[model samples]
Target: MTRTIARLALAAAGLALLPGLAQAQKNAPHNDIAAQAEQVFRSSFRADNPKYWMTRLDQDEAMRLCSQYRDNPPPKMRAQIEKAQMATIRYPVEGKLIGDWKEGEKLAAVGTGGHIGFIQPDPPGRLRGGNCYACHQLAKKEVAYGTIGPSLQHFGKLRGNSDEIIKYTYDKIYNSNAFSACTNMPRFGLHSWLTPEQISHIVAFLVDPESPVNKD
Candidate 1:
């Protein structure tokens, strides 16, 4: 009689759990939660921040698609993004793809003036830089470097400073997604953060034989 009662109790417990299990299965996350999370994320930032800083949060087409696809879009969508971004690349009026590598060295090393700060945002008209060392190993002497992107220490040494190399390096700096969609590399020239001439200097930094990236 006790065994029969215990079996009945177990059956009752199982029956009670069925509704909760069903609800759990049906409550999978979707748009509502995503919207809420995004709202919470936005609220974390200061609303009084400068327009330039606030605007950075707004997503462009590529950025929107990248987030939707989790930064791993299929080939068709990836190609579409690259094509659209490539159209935005501009060349200097003088059509120079290479500039003074010396200047590029300065830009690549300086990581200040980022726009992410709120209470103490960068002062207006402050100079920004590629902050390349934040993501890439540019020169061998720089022991402290990020590994998010490949080490470019021997970039020019490995890839000769040919016209093709110069053009590719310049375009990549101007708009990295033009070559690799949803890339972590910033679209320096595309967003006017860096001018075409500035990009050309970075190109020289990457492909110039005399640049520390190559020689040192």
Candidate 2:
């Protein structure tokens, strides 16, 4: 038991050390590279912009953890991180998790919010989108969708409308990290990338028989 415990500790230590060793072998100072990158990145932005936007370049706890593990944290740590993330999800207040799929279709198609050219964000009233097409193929009709995520065409046909499945899909879109510790999926809901109503509508698009997603 003692030997096994020692071996596990050494393995964990080695995993932690690996990235640093690689960084050092390049004869580069860690903070210097990071600071230089940040300087270059910030220089691209206008100084008149909101300070909060600049703050986003800094890492939060979750971002730091994922970076430390290279997005492959150990099983135990991953579960802990996921549990913490799951707690962040806020369900709808009106108990309405489904909305009009027509609205959702529009939301899914809207891709103008993030990191766009010269213009800064309009005040809070600006419409945001799921931008699902950027990483997911939603329907056969949309010939220009991305392939980063699994094809969601015929999603309803394959996965029936059950409370459990609906809830899982909702939560997955809300905070994908809850389902996949190192998922490439963005934390849409957790990051306010989408609202509950918006998410519900997207869910409707995925599950509604009359939605184009199902027809395609």
Highest lDDT against the true fold, candidate: 1
Candidate 1 to native Cα RMSD, angstroms: 16.5
Q: Which ten residues in a row have the lowest lDDT in candidate 2?
A: 20-29
Q: Least accurate stretch of 10 residues (summed lDDT) in model 1? A: 20-29
Residue 39 displacement in candidate 2 (angstroms): 9.3
lDDT of 1: 0.85
lDDT of each: 0.85, 0.79
| Clashes found in each candidate (C-alpha, N, C closer than 3 A) | 0, 0
lDDT tens readout by residue for model 1, 76-191: 66776798899999999999999999999999987877656745667877789999999899888888899999899989899898999888898898899999999888899989
